[model samples]
Target: MKKNSLILSVLLVGITACSTVTIKPEGQNKLVNKPTYQDSKPFYLWGLSGEHRVDVLKVCNKNEPLQMQSQQTFSDGVLALITLGIYAPHTVKVWCPKEES
Candidate 1:
């Protein structure tokens, strides 16, 4: 039980520590709402190569997103751990600017 607890704690710390966030300069003061789009991006060979381009504008219907964030979630971390760093994935989230009233 103690060993399981230690592993769980370590995983939680790793997942949290790997989180990343980016806010566009133009959208700095924009009100942040729910994410407009979310997806998991796959990378191979320990993230050395893959389709890293995420079309935020296309996902946001040609409008640039106010913010974009990419991070390794618990599942992403688990998969990477299971694959021994061979296959890795990250969760991507985009927040689009609110429509003008």
Candidate 2:
């Protein structure tokens, strides 16, 4: 009984340890009351192996984000996996030229 309880506790800790969230463009802020969403490009998240913690900073570091795809997860005693779909790649680079502009 004690061993089972110990295992369950550990499992619970692992399951909810991470979560997924998405961000959108600044312009989209005016489109609706709630601007943010679980962003996706055109692909689907089938066979989800783990959690997908989202961050917009991901876009800036990489190119325009193939299929605008980004996700993260801790993969079973291994490295945290980051995956993105490459259906469509970015053509032009867009950046905030001015912080206010």
lDDT of each: 0.77, 0.34
For candidate 1, write residues 21-89 as lDDT tens digits. 666676376445778888898998767778777888888788877788887777787787788778889
Provide the lDDT at 95 for model 1: 86
TM of each candidate vs. truth: 0.69, 0.25
- Per-residue accuracy of model 2 over 11-100 as CA lDDT, tens digit each: 756643433333345554322232223333232233233333444345445333222223333331112212332222111122321223
Query: What is the alpha-carbon RMSD of candidate 2 to the true structure?
Result: 12.2
TM-score of 2: 0.25
